[model samples]
Target: MPVRREHRTRTATRTNCISAINGTAVGAGDHAAIVWPLLCGVAKAKYYLMTADFIGGREAERIGLVSLCAPRARVLGRVLEVAAQLARGSQTAISGTKKSLSNWMRMAGPIFDNSLVLEMLGFLGPDAREGIGAMRAKRAPEFPSAKLPGAAQ
Candidate 1:
């Protein structure tokens, strides 16, 4: 679905003013190791990413993961309004500010790359197969990794 498509197509140059209308947010790709910690905080990011917990829009905003939450019907309009406001500002100033803020993520680039490598390794393992199967079956994954001796249940 849409989440998978988003994960595949997401680009770094996209505007960062995220607004969620409906549905839960899960840490995906480099977002878990890099973007989430920068948006929210380390503790909040760790709690959600490590648990793979789904966070609703309102809670996401409250936790600073999202810029705002809007009603489903109003989401597009709200986003366009924010865009228009940005478009009216001094482009150079906005671009400079954005670039400066993005340096935070740039500093974590090596960590993000390492996490991506680990994520790819996970995809090659049995747990990934179980995770995909569970998603397809609409059930909880009995991850093969969790079955190892002394592993947490």
Candidate 2:
């Protein structure tokens, strides 16, 4: 019973978070449209538009979605403040330095296998028992840590 409530709470949080980032204009299935541009903004190193005056922007900041935050009404003023500072500074040097470092980081590969390992383990783990139970029960998982090697019995 507690697990079901927790599952619904988590799901609602996820859905609300997505809806906050993506306004109703693009609708549900087309959420990817917003995501691609946001990634492009990050790659090009620009501050992407905040979907909501408060909520989505908060989540974005939590996830490195933006460079800074302003009061919900002060966005333009905040932007101008940064722009004027940058305009007066050494733009060429800054641009070149950023380009070089970003390019270097982008090329660092033999891409870490962290993602693949996590996915594999998440599905195959003995610790995943509760998760699979939740899945079969049409609920979210609540696995115990007991199966992990260092966990206390």
Candidate 3:
């Protein structure tokens, strides 16, 4: 099935202060293609996105994917502390800074839109079905797109 046109809209911008504890991070959909590059650099983004590797908290912070990594037990407390500090800051200054930085992402709107279209199209192809089947069967995906013409199975 094709993705609905209305569902292809760009994600809304918001102030994100990511903090990770014990869990890992993986970019879903447009996240790897767009958001990851905006947060980290292209090299790091591509490495992680392409591999679909699980990123630990420390690795995530080192790559600039997260603002901080807190001990699992202290995660909630750390989050509240950061929230409190932000709440004390001047809203006008914070809002303006966010808008300025967000313009960088806005500049990539065309690229993001094109990538999104391609990604959605992939969902309608044979590889998508094979991928899902492989996952359900607990086996590595033998993507249809990876098959070469006249190659024996």
Best model number under TM-score: 3
For model 2 the local lDDT of residue 2 reads 45
Candidate 2 — which residues are off by over 4 angstroms?
Answer: 1-55, 104-153
lDDT of each: 0.74, 0.46, 0.72
- 1 or 2: which has the higher TM-score? 1
Candidate 2 per-residue C-alpha lDDT over 83-114 given as tens digits, one digit per residue, 9 for 90 to 100:
67766768677566656544533342222234
What would the per-residue lDDT of candidate 3 be over residues 20-68, giving only the tens digit for each residue?
A: 3555544554345767887789999888877677888888789888788
- From the highest lDDT down, the ranking of the candidates is 1, 3, 2
Candidate 3 Cα RMSD after full superposition onto the native fold (Å)? 4.2
- The regions of model 1 sitting more than 4 angstroms off are 1-27, 147-153
Model 1, position 2: C-alpha lDDT score: 49
Q: Which stretches of candidate 3 lie over 4 Å from their true place?
A: 1-26, 147-153
Colliding pairs, model 2: none
Residue 80 shift from truth in candidate 1, angstroms? 1.4
TM-score of 1: 0.78
Q: Candidate 1, which ten residues in sequence have the lowest lDDT sum?
A: 3-12
Instruction: Write the number of the candidate with greater lDDT, choosing between 1 and 3.
Output: 1
TM-score for all models, in order of appearance: 0.78, 0.34, 0.79
- Given candidate 2, what's the lDDT at residue 110? 22
TM-score-based ranking: 3, 1, 2
Deviation of model 1 at 139, angstroms: 3.1
